[model samples]
Target: MIETEAWVLYERSGGSESALDSDDFRRETFAFPGPAGDELLVEPLFGSWEGNMTHSLQRRPIDICKQRGERRVVIGNGSVLRVLRAGADVRGIHEGDVGILHGGHVQDEFGYTVLVQGYDAPGTVGVLAKRTKIAARNFLPLPLESHHRLEQWAAFSVRYLTAWSNYHLALGAYRLQVNEPLDPAPFVLGWGGGSTLAALDLARRAGCRAAMVSGSPQRLAELARMGIVGIDRRAFAGLEFDEGRYASDPEYHAAYRAAERAFLAAVHDWTGGRGAAIVFDYIGAPVFRASVKALGRQGVLATAGWLLGMQTTVNRAIECIGRHVHVHSHYIRRADSPKAMRYAEREGWMPQVSEIYSWEEIGGLARAAAAGRLRSYFPVYRVNPV
Candidate 1:
C-alpha cells in the first residue's frame, strides 16, 4: 500500500442551508490499497466544477468542489484522472495512461465497483476502478502525449462528452424515437459555458446552425468567431417585459424574463421565424420556459443543470396543445464519453481554460468560489505532472 494525502469535503449530517456553513473539509493521508481485481488506481490531475446542480451538496447556489474535495470524483467537466497503478488483471489501462473520470455507475454484471467518495468511510481510501464491458462503459482514453496543456485534456473529458450526448443521444435519439430521421438541425444553446462550446462544435460537425445566449461578452465573442449567432443577455438585464407580470423585484426576475424573451426573439430570427429544432438549457426556470417557447413543432429541449433554481413555471397551455415539444432531462451516459472522445480526437477538439491553479491553491480557490468571487470560463487544477 502506498501512502498519499487527499483533500475531502465532509457534509455534516442534517445541517444548514448554506453548503459552506454546513460542510467542512480536511486533508488526510491514507494508504492507497492496491487495486483488488480489475481496479485501476488513479490520481486526479486537472478538474473543474460545473457549479450547478450535481456538484451542490444541499442544493447550494454555488459549487464548492470545483476548487477542492473528492466527493463524486468523476463529476466535474474537465476532471482528468491519471493512472498511477494498475491491478494485474486490469486491461486497456497503464501506469502512465490518462482518462476522464465520469459520474456514471458500473452495472452489477460488469463486476466493477463504483466508488462515489471515501467521505462516508473515514480512514479508508476510496478506489474507483474502470473496466471495459460489452455494454455500458465510463472511462475514455485520450491521445498519448500529443496534447499540450493537461487542462485542455481535462476540459475535453466531460464538457465535450456532455455536449455530444445532448445532441446525439438526447436530441438525435429522441428524433429517432419519434420515427423521424436524425438530421442536421438548428440549435439554441443557452448559457455560454463549456458544454455549450462543445455543442457548438457538434452543431458544426453535423452541419447544423446554432445561436447562443450569454452574459459574458468574451464567451459571446468566442462563439461569434466560430460563426455562431450570439445574443447578449446582458442587454436585456434591465428591459421590462409582460408589464412586469413575472416581476420579483426592482431589477431581478423581471430583467431575467425580459432576457428570455429577447433570447427567444433572437432564436426566432436566427432560425428564420421557425424557432429551433433543439434548445440546450443549463440555466433553469425562465430559460427553460424560453426554451420551450422557442421550440418549433416537434422540437426537443434538453436540460442538464439548474444554476438558478430547479422549480420552473412554463405555459401549461403550450405544453398541452400548442406544440409537440419534448422536454428531456439530459444526463450523459457512460457509453457517451468514449464516443465523444473519439469524435474530439478526429476533430482535434480541446477546452478553452480561463484559469489554472496549482494543486496547492485548492483551499483558497474553494473559499473564493464559495463567496461567488471566482470568475472563470474553466478553472483547471493540476495535481501531478506527467
Candidate 2:
C-alpha cells in the first residue's frame, strides 16, 4: 500500500497579539485564517503560500520512504519527480506510472500533491493516493536549500503552464466574444514567406472562406497545394516606363502617376464592388494603409510582419471615425512544443518537412532562406544524431 502525508509550517510568535500583529512573523507563515475585509490581513511579505505548501508537502514522500525502511521512493508527475531528484539521500522517481489518486482524498484548496501507485504503460506514471488532508502523508519535513535545483524546475514548469494557460484563455475569448462568422469570403493580402502562410492558415481555420493574394506565383502555388485558393499578382504585365524623362520632367511624372492609378484600379477591380472582410498585410506601410482604405465597415486588417518597414504616420482620429475599420498587429512567437507541432502535423495543417540537417548546415540554411531558394513550408530542425 502507498502512503503519504500533509503538513503546515507556521512561524512562531510569543503572544496572541504577537501572532496577530507581528508582520515579520506572519510574513514567513504559509497559510493563515481570514474573514472578509481581514482577507488582506495575513499577507505574507516574504514568499507565496503555494510555494511554502509545496515545500511542506514534498517532505511526506521522503519521510514515508525513510520510516518504512525502503531504499527508494517513487514520485510521479514531472514536477514532483524533479523535487524528489533534488533532495539528498532520496531515490528519485522515474516516469512509468498509471494509477491516478482519487481527487476527494485530499483538500482541494492547494490541489498539488498526489501519491503514485505504479505504471500503465512504458513511460506514463500512475497516481494511487491524491489530495489527502492527513499530515502523516506529507514527507521530507525539512527546509528547502537556498539555491535549490527543485525550485528552478518548479519555476520553469509554472512559467510554461502559465503561458500555455494564457494562450488558451485568449483563444477562448476569441471563440466566445471576439470572433464572428464572416460571409462573401475575404481577400487576404499575403507578403513575405513564412508568416504569410501562417496567416492564411489561421484565416482558413477561423472559417474565412477567402482567396489569398500574393506577389509571388511560387508562393501562391504552394498555398494552392494546401487547398487554399489564391490570386497571383506576379501574373500582371509590367507597364513600359518613359525612362528618357527625369522625375522633374512632365513625361516621367505623368508615367509615375499613371502607374499609381493603374495599381489602385487593379486593386479595386480585384476586390469587386464589396470590400474585403479581412486583409492579411505583411508588406510596407503604404500597402498597409491601402489595405485599410480597401476594407468595408467592420473589416479587419491583421499585420504579422513589419520586415519591409514599420513607421506609418496616420491621422488616427479621422481614420477611426470615417473608416470604422480595425487595424491589429499580430506578433506570434513560435511555441516551443514538440507535442503541439506533432499535433499540427497529424492534423495535416502543418506541412511535412523535406529534410533534416546536421548543426554544421545551419549557416548554409540561413543563406538559403535569405536567398528565397528554400521552400519555407517545412519546419527545419538541426539534429545531432550522435
Candidate 3:
C-alpha cells in the first residue's frame, strides 16, 4: 500500500450553506492498495470545481458525504489523471498515459446514469487526492498529441459529457415538435452556469443560432467573443416563480408578471419574434417560469443543472399537446461518455475557464461558487503538478 494525502470532508454543512466554512474539510493520510481487477493506480493532475459543489457539501439534496454506510468521504466528480500503473485486466489505458477520469459509476438498464462515482457511489473514491486506485472503467484516456492543455481537459471531464448529452436531448425534443430538417437550424438559447456555456458552444457549432443569458458581464463578453448573442440576465431580475410568495405577496405577483413579460419580449426580439426553438436551462427554480414561458410553440426547455434550487412547481395540464411546450430534463446518459470525449478530442469542445484555485483553497472555492461570484463559467483547481 502507498501512503497518500487526500482532502477529506468529515462532516456535512447540513441544511444551511453558511456552515460550509466549518473545519470539516481537512487533509488526512490514506493508504491506497495496488491496482487489481481492472483498477488503475493514478495521480490526479487537475480537478474541476463543480459549480454545485456546495450542494454536495451542504448535504441538502444528495448527501454524498457518506455512502454504503461509510462516513467521512473524499468527494469529487471530475479530474484529469496520469496513469501510474494499470491492472492486468485493463484495456486501452496503459501506464504513463494521461486521461480525463469519469464519474458515471453505474448506469440504468437503458444506459442512463443512476449512480455517479466519487460523489454518491459506494467504495468509489474521488480525485481530490494525491494518488488513488480506481476501476479502469472510469478512465477516459486523452490523446498525447492533443493541443488543449491538461487543465482545459480537466475542465471537460464530466462537464462536456453532461453538456453534450443535454444539448442532444434538447435538440431531439425540438425536432420532435418542429418536424423539420437542419436546413434552417433552430435558435438555441442557453441560460445557466458552466455546463450551459459548453452546450451553447455545441449549438453554435451545429449551425444553430446560439445565445447565452448570463448575469456575469464577463461571461456575456466571453460568449459574445465566440459570436453567440449575449442576453443580460439582470433584465429578468424579479421573475422567480416562488409558489408561496406568488400566492401571498401581491407585489411579487406583479413583479413576476412584469419580469416574465420583459423576458418573453426580449426572447422574441432576439429570435426575430419566432421565439427560441430550444431553451437549455439548468439554473432550476429561479429561472424556471421565465424560461418555460419564453419558449415558442412546440419549443423545448431542456435542463440538467440544478445549481440554484431543485424543486419547482410545473403544471402538467398547462404544458402539453395544444400548449406545444416540452420539458426535457434528465441527467447525463451513459452513451454520452465516449462520444462526448471524442467531440472534445476531435472538435476541441473544452470549457472556457475563469479561475483555477489551489487544493488548500478548495473550501473557499465552494463558497464562492455558491455565492455566484466566480468570473468564469468554468472554474477549476490544481490537484497535482501537470
Candidate 4:
C-alpha cells in the first residue's frame, strides 16, 4: 500500500447549515491501495470546489461511503491530473499523460452522471490527496502540448464540460423555434454562475447577442469586456420568492409581483420587447419564475442548478401553453461529455477564477465558500506541484 497524505474530517457535520463550523480538516497519512486493473494512479495538479458537496460535509447517511459503513473518505471531484502509473490492462493512456476528471458514480446509458461522485463514490479518493486512483474511462485528455496554463486547465477541467454540453442544448432548442429566417442572431441571457458564464461565452461566440445578470460588478464588467451585456441583479431586490412565504404572506407575494414587473419591463426595454430566445437559469427556485417569464414566445429556458433553495413552485399552465416557453432541464448528455474539455481549450473559453488557494488552506476555502465570501464565480486550489 502506498501511503497518501490527505486532509480528512473524521466527523461529519450534523446539519447543512454548519458545514464549516464542525469537523475541522486535518492533514494525515492514509493507506492507498494503488490502482486496479482498469484504474490509473493520478497526481492532481489542481482541484475546484462545488456547492453540491454539502451532502458529504454534512455527513448525510445517503452518502455512498456512509451507506457502505466507511468513515474516512477523501473529498475532491473536479481535477486536472497527470497519470503516474497505469494498470497493465490500460491502453492509449500511459505514464505521463495529462487529463481532466469529471466525477460521477454509476453513469447511465446517455453517459452523464446519475449520482454525484468525489466523496459520493465508493472506494474513490479525490484530487485533494497527494495521489489517487481513477478508472481510465473517466479521464479525458487535453490536446497534445496544450498551451493553456495549469490554473486555466484546472478551472476549465470541471465546469466548462457541463457548460458546453448544456448550452448546446439551449442553443439547439432556440434554433428549433427561432431560425435564421426569423432571427439570424437570437439574443441569449444567463444568470450568474460559473456554468452560466461559460454558456454565455459560447452564446457570444456563436453570434448571438448575449447578456448575463450578476450581482457582482467585477464579474459583470469582466464579461462585458468580453462583449456580453451585463445586467445588474440588484436592480430587482427581494425577489428571492420562497414557496412558503409566497403562499401565505400576501405582502410577500405583492412585493415579488412588483419586482417581477420591474424585471420584465427591464427585459422589454433591453430587447425591444423581443424577449430572450434562450434564458439560462441554473440558480433554481429563488429566480426560476422570473427566468421563465422573461422568455419570449417560443423561447427556451434552461436550468439545472439548485444551490440556494430546492423546492420550486411554477405556473405550469401559463408558461407552457400561454407563453410557448420550453424548459430544457438536465445536465450534459452522454455523447456531449467526452470532448468538451478539448473543445473549450480550442475555443479558449475558460471560466474565470478570482482566487487560488494553497494546499494547507483547504479549511479556509470551505469556510469562505460556505460564508459566501468567495469573490469569484469559480475558485481553484493547488493539490500537487505538477
**What are the Cα lDDT values of the candidates?**
0.57, 0.35, 0.76, 0.75
Q: Which numbered prediction scores highest in lDDT against the true structure?
A: 3
Model 2: runs farther than 4 Å from truth?
1-187, 235-271, 322-346, 355-357, 370-379
lDDT of 3 by residue, 238-318 (tens): 777787888999999999889888888889898888878888888888888777777777788887767677777777766
Give the lowest summed-lDDT range of ten residues in model 2. Answer: 39-48
Query: Highest TM-score: which candidate?
Result: 3
Q: Report clash pairs, candidate 3.
A: none
Each candidate: RMSD: 5.7, 20.1, 2.3, 2.4
Give lDDT tens digits, candidate 1, residues 1-386. 65566554553444445545423644455444455566666776676655532334333643334333433221223356777667677677777777776644332444322322321212223221121111113446666665446677776655666677666644554465344344445554555366766776677666677777777777778878877777787766643233336554656665666677776677777787876767777666645666677777666777655555567666667765744455544446665466666666667766777788776776666666666656665666666665
Worst 10 residues of 3 by lDDT: 13-22
lDDT of candidate 4 vs native?
0.75
Tell me which of candidates 1 and 4 scores higher on TM-score.
4
Ranking by lDDT: 3, 4, 1, 2
TM-score, one value per model = 0.77, 0.44, 0.92, 0.92
**RMSD of model 4, in Å?**
2.4
Candidate 3 wrongly placed segments (more than 4 Å): 13-18, 32-34, 66-68, 181-183, 322-331
Q: How displaced is residue 353 in candidate 1, in Å? A: 2.2
lDDT for position 244 in model 3: 87
How does candidate 1 score on lDDT?
0.57
